[model samples]
Target: MAKQRKIIHVDMDAFFASVEQRDHPEYKGKPLIVGGQPNSRGVVAACSYEARKYGIHSAMPCSRAYRLCSHALFVPPRFDAYREVSNQIRDIFWRYATEVEPLSLDEAYLDVTYTEAFNGSATLIAQAIKREILQETRLTASAGVSYNKFLAKIASDMDKPNGLYVIRPEQGEAFVAALPVGKFHGIGPATETKMHNLGIHTGKNLREKSLTELTERFGKAGQYYYNIARAIDERPVRSQRIRKSLGKETTFAEDIHSIPELTAKLLDLAERVFESLSKQNLKARTITVKVKYADFQQVTRAHSTEHIIQLTDLKQIIPLLLEKTEAGIKPVRLVGLSMSGFDVPVLQTHQPQLDLALNDEF
Candidate 1:
C-alpha cells in the first residue's frame, strides 16, 4: 500500500482586517474594510468577519462595500504589517514541518509526513501550530488536517476563525460527496455556473459523469474534476515552487492618452516593482511592461538585459518597452511593470506566456 501523506492547511481568518484590528483595538468588534477608501476606484482586498454580515467580501468595490455598510470603516492595507505577520506564522509552521507551501501571505499547506513532532500526528501538529500562532501573534487561525492537499484545504475551511477540522482517508469520499461544487477550492464562479448548468451541483452529481463526458464539457480541467470528485488529488505539497515572476500594476480612475502622463505612471510602476524585487532579494534579467487601453484592450512588451537588472537600468528600458505599445495614442487605463528571468539557479525554469488582461490592473 502507498504511504498516506499527512498534510495540514493553515489559514489566518480575516488576515488583513485582523491585523488592522490587532494594531488598533478600536477597530475590533466592528465592521472593518481593508483595501481602499470608499471614494477610491479600487476594490476590497479583505474585510473583517463583522463586515461579512453586511454582505461585504474581498474583491468587491470599496464604494459598493460602503453602500452595503455605510457606517463601516474603510482602511488601506499595510502590506508590511501583513508581511511581517506572514513571516512570523511561517516561522511557526517551519518549527513543525520542513515542507511548507505558502499559498499567500495568510495561508499555507504543510506536509508533515516525516516530521518527528507530535509523534507524526498531523492533528497534534495542527493544534500546536494554531496555539503557537495565537500565543505569538495574538491572532487566530483555522486549520484543516487530511491525507492530501485537496482534503486539507477543504478541511481547513470547514470551520471558521480559531477552529480545527480533520478528514481521514476513509471519510474523504463521503465528505466530498456531500460538498457543493461551488465549495470546492479550485471551482470558481464560472466553473460553478457551468457545473450547475450540467446538473452537477454537488460532488455526488459530479461523480455521476464519465471522464470523457466531463472532458467534452469542461475541456482540460475535466480530468482534474473527475479525480477530485473521487477525492483523489495526487498533487504533492511542493515546498520549492519557485517564483515565476514579480510585477506591479495600477488602474486609473480616468484614462489618459498623453505620452508624458503614461511615462510618469510607468516610472512609478517600475519603482514599485523594483522595491518589491529588492525586498524579496531577487534580481531579474528581463523587464516587462503592460498597457491597458480605455476600450478594454491590452498589450505587453519585454526586454531582457545581458545581466541582472537594476533600478536605473529599468528606468531606461521602460520607455523603450513602452515604444512597443500604442499607449500614448490609445487612451490608457492601466499600466504594469514586472521583472522576471530570475538569477537563481534552478533545476528547471519555465517562463509563463504573458497574457495581459483587458480589465485587470495587474
Candidate 2:
C-alpha cells in the first residue's frame, strides 16, 4: 500500500488590510482600502472586512469599488511593512517543515510528511501549527491538512480567518464531488460562466464531462481540474525561491502637465530611488523611470551603470527625461522611479522556534 501523504496549508486572514487595522486601532471595524486612487486606473490591493461587506474585494478596479463602498477609507499600500510581516510568518512556517512553499504574503503550503510531529497524523500537526502561529503573531490563520496541495489549499479556505480543516484520504473524494466549480482555485469568473452553460456547476458535474471534452473546453487546465475533482492533486510542496524585484512607484499629489514640472517630478523620484536602494543594500546599474501621461499613455526609460549605484546617476539621467517623454508624452499624468538588482543576504538561515501567544479559547 502507498504511504499516507501529509500536507498543510495556512493562510493569514485578510492579510494586508488586517495588518493595517492591527497597527492602527482606530482603523478597525471601518471600511479600509489599501491601493492607488480610485479614478486613475487604480486597483484594490486589499480591503478590510467592513469594505468586503460592501462587495468590495482585491483586484476590483478602485473606481468600481469606490462606487460600491463610498464610505471606505482609501489608504495607499504599505508594501514595506507588509513584507516585514511576511518574513516573520515565513520564519514561523520553517519550524515545522523544510519544504515550505509560499503562495503569496498571506498563505503557504508546508510538507510535513517528514516532520517528527506527523507520526501518521497530518491533522494534529496542522492544528498545533495554527495555534502556534496565532500565539506568536497575535493574528489568526486558517489551516487545512490533506494528502496533496489542491485539496489542502481548498480545505484551508473552507473555514477561514481561524479554522483547522482536515480531509482524510478516505473522505477526500466525496468532499471534492460536492464542491462547487466556482470554488476551485483556477476557475475564474469567465471560465465558470462557460462551465455553467455546459451544465457543469459542481465538481460532480465536471466529473461527468469526459476528460477529452473538458480538455477541449478548458485546455491544459482541464487536466488539472480532472485530478482536483477527484481530490488527486499530486503536486509536492517546495521551498521559497529568491524574489525577483524590489521597487517602488509614486503618483504626484497633483498631475504634472508641463515640460518643466515633469523634470522636477524626476528629482523627487530620484530621492525615493536612492532611499530604497540604500535600505536594501543594493547597487543597481539599472534605474528605470515609469511615466504615465494625462491620457494614461505610458513610457519607461532606463539608465544603466557598470559602476555601483550612486545618487549622481540620477543627476546624469534627469536630463534625458524630455526625450524619453516624446514618443508617449501626451501631458504626463504620473511619474515613477524604480531601481532593480537588489539581493537579500541569503546566508541568514536559522532554525527558528515557534513563538506561540495564545488567548486560549475553548
Candidate 3:
C-alpha cells in the first residue's frame, strides 16, 4: 500500500494589508484598505482585518467599501514590496520541503511526506514554518496539516491569523460531514446557492447524493465534488504548475456605446496581452475576444489560426471580431482579449486561416 501523503497549506493573514500596515506603523490597528481610491471604479484588492469588521473584503467595489467604513484608510497596492516579501516566504518554504506548490504570492502547499525533519511529523513541520515566517518577515501565517491537499487547504482556514490546525487521517470524514457546504473551498457562492436549493447543505448531505446525480447537475466538476464530500481527494501536490493561457481585461466606470471606443479599448488590451506573451516567450494560436454588456450579459468570440498571432494580425482581426458582438448596439461595460492553444507550433504546410467560432465563453 502507498503511504499517505503529508501536506501542509500555509496562508498569510491579510497579506497585502498586513504588509502595508507593517511598513506604516500609524496604519497598524486601523482599518486599512489596499487598492484604489474610494472614489475610483477599482475594487478592493485587500483590506486589513479591522476593515473586515465593517463587512469590507477583497473584490468589493472601493465605493461600496468606502460606504461601509467612511474613515478607513485607502491605499494602492505596492506589488514590488509584496513580491519581495513573497520571495522571502518562498525561500523559507524551500528550506524544509523540496515539494512546494505555490497557490499565490501569499499561500502554498508543501508536501513533507518524505522529509526527515521533525521526525516526519507534518504538524511539527507546519509549526516550524509558521515560526520562521513570523520571525523572518514579521508576518503571521495560518497552517493546516492533513493527509490530502483538499483537507489541508480547508484546515488552514479553520483558524486565522497565526493559527495552526491539524486534521488526522481518521478525522477527515467526520470533520467534512459536519462542515457547511458553503465552507467547502471549491463551492463558490453560485454553487452554494444551487446546492442549498437541492437540499445539499453539508458534506453529509452532499455525500447522500449519488455520483450520477451530481454529474447530471454539475457535469465534469461533479466528480470532484463527489470525492471531496467523502473526504477523498486524490490530487497530488504538483510542484510545477504550467501556464495554459494569458489574458487581460478591464471594467469601465461608464458603459461604452461606440464601436471606435470599444475597438480602442480592445487594442490596448491586445497590446498588454501581447506584452505578457512576449515576456513569457510564448506564442498563441488562438485569440478570443470577450465583451460584457451593461446588463451583465457576457459573450465571447474566438479565432484560431495555424500561424502565431501577431500584433498586425490582431489589429486587423479585432475590428472584425467586434462586428460579431452586440457591443456598440448595447452599451458595453467590459472588454477583454486572451490568447491560448500554446502547445502547437506553427506549421509550414498549411496557410494561416481564420477559424472563427461563436458562443465561446471566457
Top-lDDT candidate index: 3
The TM-score, computed over Cα atoms with residue i paired to residue i, of candidate 2 is 0.69
lDDT of candidate 1 vs native? 0.87
- 61 Cα displacement, candidate 2 (Å): 3.1
lDDT of 1 by residue, 1-362 (tens): 33457889999999999999999999999999998898887789999999999999998878899999999999989999999999999999989885788999999999777667666678888999999999999999999999889989999988898899999888999998999999998999999999999999999999999999999998999999999999998887777787979998898887888877788888888888888888988889998888988776899999997888888886578778788899778888788888899987674423223332212110
lDDT of 2 at 92: 80
| Ranked by TM-score, top first | 3, 1, 2
User: Candidate 2 at 66: error in angstroms?
Assistant: 3.3
For model 2, how does the per-residue alpha-carbon lDDT over 1-362 read when each residue is reduced to its tens digit? 33456788999888899889888888999999998777756779998878998999997768888899877888888989888888888888878775888989889998776566545356777777778777766678899888888888998998876888888778888888898999988899999999999999998998888889979988998898788887888876767455445456665555666756666667777787678667757666677778877566678887776776677767667657556666234666567777765545553333224422221111
Q: Where does model 2 exceed 4 Å of error?
A: 37-41, 118-120, 240-362
C-alpha lDDT values of all predictions: 0.87, 0.77, 0.88
Clashes of 3: 0
Return whichever of 2 and 3 wins on TM-score.
3
TM-score of each: 0.82, 0.69, 0.91
Off by over 4 Å in 3: 295-297, 344-362
- Expressed as tens digits, the lDDT of each residue in 1-362 for candidate 3 is 34567889999999999999999999999999999898887789999999999999998889999999999999999999999999999999988875788999999998777666777778888889999999999999999999899999999999997899998988999999999999998999999999999999999999999999999999999999999999998877777676677999998978899999898998999999989988878889899999988777899999999888898898889888999999779999788899998864443322112322211110
How far in Å is the alpha carbon of 202 misplaced in model 3? 0.6
